[model samples]
Target: MFDCIDWVNLPTFFSMLVARSTIAPVLAAATETEPEAESSVVLAGVLLSLVAIYFASKIGGEICARINLPPVLGDLVGGVVVGISALNLLVFPDSGALGSDSLIMSILQSTSSLTPEALQVTFEAQSEVISVLSELGVVILLFEIGLESELSELIKYGPQAAIVAVVGVVLPFTLGTMGLIAFFGVATIPAIFAGAALTATSIGITAKVLAEIGRLSSKEGQIIIGAAVLDDVLGIIILAVVASLVKTGEIEVMNIIYLTISAGAFLVGTIVLGRLLGPYFVALVKELKTRGPLLISALIFAFLLSYVAAAIQLEAILGAFAAGLVLGETEIQEELEKQVIPISDMLVPIFFVVVGARTDLAVLDPTVPSNRAGLAIAAFLIVVAIVGKVVTGFTVFGQPDIKRLGIGVGMIPRGEVGLVFAGVGAASGVLSDSLQAAVIVMVILTTFIAPPWLRIVFNDSDRLETVQEE
Candidate 1:
């Protein structure tokens, strides 16, 4: 077509042509933005989930505090309140609709009656982000624990901590494995995995309890912290071996031996090497002009160690914990803690709520045949989990003021580590659904009971100390 163009507007016409050519493709891609838009809804759901968890935790914590209980109990209970098992409060959408239009969804919008598939879909969709947040929260929490911890104290009590860790790991692993085999009649791999679940004591929970009671710096608290850290190292080693067995269907003795040595080496090596180098790194960062460079630098260090630990097949938290230990020894320890505490407070509750959300009482019902079987197995495992850890407290030698019972109870909460073990097993098809549910039951009991019980023991110890002084 021959075009008539005004001389002054010629540039405008060409510009419009260029704009039309480029803008058409851009507008075409706008159709594809629907997927991205859909993702925004999912993001909103995640944010809402967080908000629900936060308020639930706050309310739960307040109620707990009113009754002289640990606030974490409330955080966990709040998780249950919003979780699929109880209130069905926070469900994500599988379709782009966010499930608002679905009759079932609408009916249960303010109540707790969600379809299993919908809940699961939502959970899996948001699982990755929530998992990362939960993990980072615990890492910060552990780092704080490390800051409050002294290396010399960790070393002085190292032998006793080692003994307590060994006892704690062995008893739970043995009892859990045997009980799964004998009582639940599960496969060897699942039984081993179940045992593995019981082996880790959530240092986050134990440390928080001790810190709240002002015992975190006490001799016994130090021992418990040391032992819990060591217990995690050992638990991961066991998990690695069991996972390999599941994959290869054959146990590799040398592989297990190598993993054990490597894990130990990595932990000790990090401590020794970090002790030599951490101060220099901190000193280098101290000259930075940024307002929060020190805190960021510490976080970078923690994250690097976490990545290293993961690369070597250990838990990332181990690396974070190691980073804290190293940084805690530096002169900037006080400043780091002051800066990090607010971050820890904000993120830690999310981790606890996630732990609680994983609990499903529906799986433990006595009315269903399979659930009854799971319930029975769960009951047995709970007893084994409790008594085994309690006995390990007595294994600590010669610290009469140690509050051995408190230490044992401190070891009780299986927390996230247990869930991780169970999850791996379930994913690998090693743990049947019911078996996983049973493990979840055992974890919840331990997680719920320990905080208050530990507080009670600590109070009793305080009273006894006062009486003796009088």
Candidate 2:
């Protein structure tokens, strides 16, 4: 039945109809029409991009789930399929104008030349909307994670967690910096930037994997979670230091110290202070007659913390996480989770898909000399990143019966944090395109490998008994 339809001619038929019916009338009426027409075009583009993202992510995720793989992996692949690199079916337009003669406008009149800035304005507007939604999605995700966590767990495992985090950061940073320097002959600053990108474990990916495998409450989960949080704090400080180095060409010890203090204070102070003030805020909100007041108030708190974190030169997600820590201790913890999960389910996919879309797989092709270099560096970094993180699991020696391999594997995924680091470096010109691509490859490989390894390590009853007996 589908073969009866002429797919190739369908687009031409629609184009002719649109040109004859819509574009012709719009152009003819332009002299009498208000400015709203142009705004509508931009709104249409933004809406279209969002619709594409949703369907692409949904289909991709479903496919991956059917294969017993992480759906997030599929979401990334889906974005790549429609992104500028491949199908180019989706348009995240550049900062150029949409002239009447442009591709979009030309659909109606192939030769008609209209206003110069029309398409550019619309594209910019669409881009801004997508950007805001992406940020909000990640912010909410961190906040939700914080809600599920207890501060006491972090406190109890503080020593081992610190060792895990410190070793995790140090080894990867060293290997990444040295490996890139040796392999690519890159400058110290660029090498450092690459190393910094490798240091942070993406707590989000690790936690999700643990949750999926039903080990989120296990002892290894506690250690891995605690270390990942600390690693995030360290990552923030490292990012600031790298940014400063790129801008000033000199590393400022005082600035690094200040950033460290600020990030530490935000985490410690927010949790402690939020815990103290949480009940009163909850009590005040309990008086509201509105539906889902607890959730609304909780989100407001999260957004506030996220804002503060951004203002203080930290990632908004950190503030969001802090908000979760505070809110998790409140009387309404379970209610908050109930409200937030559905929202997270919708938004988190957006963040992951956008991240995937940003990745251009073409850059990893070894046929191109620069890209070949990047691929080589990426290969080196992947090995270093895995081994460096795996070693941290041994740092858990003090804790008996803990699955060291599981903890190590749990800390392996670099995920979003690594991307954030590479993005910053790339934006600053410290990381050349190839180096940035390499970092991305490292991030992708680490993220892809860690989860399955974790599942295997966790499910090995024989290994578990051997370790327990030993």
Candidate 3:
């Protein structure tokens, strides 16, 4: 009977059964492996993005440095060139860009086995990673600024700084809000949001410029830094109030009070507590035997405070700045500052470049039918943004012979801060397309103009002072 059934055929039938038994496990393994493969693709995208950012920053920075401009401006320019407005090499999802819109994504797709769906997921993941890194860059930057600043000087100029902050907030807000309502005929909520946008002062850009020019420790620089810090706190409060208005159609008094009080308390408490704990911190770092014990420990402290600040609904950069101020009072401040520079060099350009990259210059294109009205409104906002902050320089009562113009110009660049306001307004649907474009244009112009303008103002002031000294 076995011979009749064909003995050789029995082995083939047995092998088929074995193959069927192994198929399920093989599929399961592949299913598990897919996520890892996706992760690798995301990482590769991020690596390429960084490469573009570093290249743009260096090239733009080099050109700007060569032309007697702030190298920071070059970083911004570099960002614009590689960003959504130009090459599309460093596009972001938050900017209403598709994965197909990014050249980097295209390159990734051509080189890898990424499917259409995988490309979308990888693009978002990569953008988010870059965004976080950019945020961290600014935090490190503020921390470095704190280290370089003299806390005593900042305190001494606190009152003057406070006045500048108050004026800077009230004037631009009042003018921009009313101007839009009267001139542009915008709705009340959108006008309020735009006004609030103008209230921002990008301390990062101003501080970086001041440092590059070796004026960071000057009296005016101290006042500018102090005022900018205060402006940030006030800006946060206003943003909360407006964002609340947008969502609920009413102001939230309790929320506003909470933000105000918490901001004030956080800044003051962090500084006071940080000072008291500074010696202990230094002592702890001294005991660690690691190669970068001091630097690593300082970063840990900064990151902790940054997290705390974020948890409390404040800007993390504020906490980083506070940490710097605290540790700045310690004995190892000088050594720590030296160690932090290389880190700053690597990270800070990412912040500036990302800010530039996120900025879409297409909004300013008058050829676009919708942009015409926006360009007109943008003109008005640009004027208001410049004048509103510029007038604050005159508000400093006791500081005779201060570079009042430089102080005002330093406060002009809204930089990434204004963009936050615009983004929030757009997200809430409170901003019309024209109004949003206007806000963006105002931001872009002020950001690009202020660096060079501030440089000129300071350069002129330096020359005048030299003549006076002579």
Ranking by lDDT: 3, 1, 2
How high is the CA lDDT of each candidate model? 0.81, 0.79, 0.94
Of 2 and 3, the candidate ahead on lDDT is 3
lDDT of 2 by residue, 1-470 (tens): 89897898999988888879977777778866433335566566556667778888999889977877667777777877766557554434331223332233333223333244444455456666776787898888888878887777767888888999999999999888887778779999999999999898988878877877777667788889889988998998888888888899888899888888898888889988998898899889979999888888888899999999999888888899889888888888888898999999888777777766666677778888889878888888888999999999998866776888888999999987888887788778788878888898998788778876787888795566879999
Q: Tell me the deviation in Å of residue 333 in model 1.
A: 1.2
Candidate with more favorable, higher TM-score: 1 or 2: 1
**By summed lDDT, which 10 consecutive residues of candidate 1 come out lowest?**
90-99
Total residue pair clashes for candidate 2: 2
- C-alpha-based local distance difference test score of model 1: 0.81
Off by over 4 Å in 1: 1-39, 91-125
Ranking of all candidate structures by their TM-score, best first: 3, 1, 2
Q: After superposition, how far is residue 350 of candidate 3 from its true place, in Å?
A: 0.8
Instruction: Estimate the lDDT of model 3.
Output: 0.94
- After TM-score superposition, the amount by which residue 116's alpha carbon in candidate 3 deviates from its true location, in angstroms, is 0.7
* Per-prediction TM-score to the true structure, in the order listed: 0.85, 0.84, 0.93
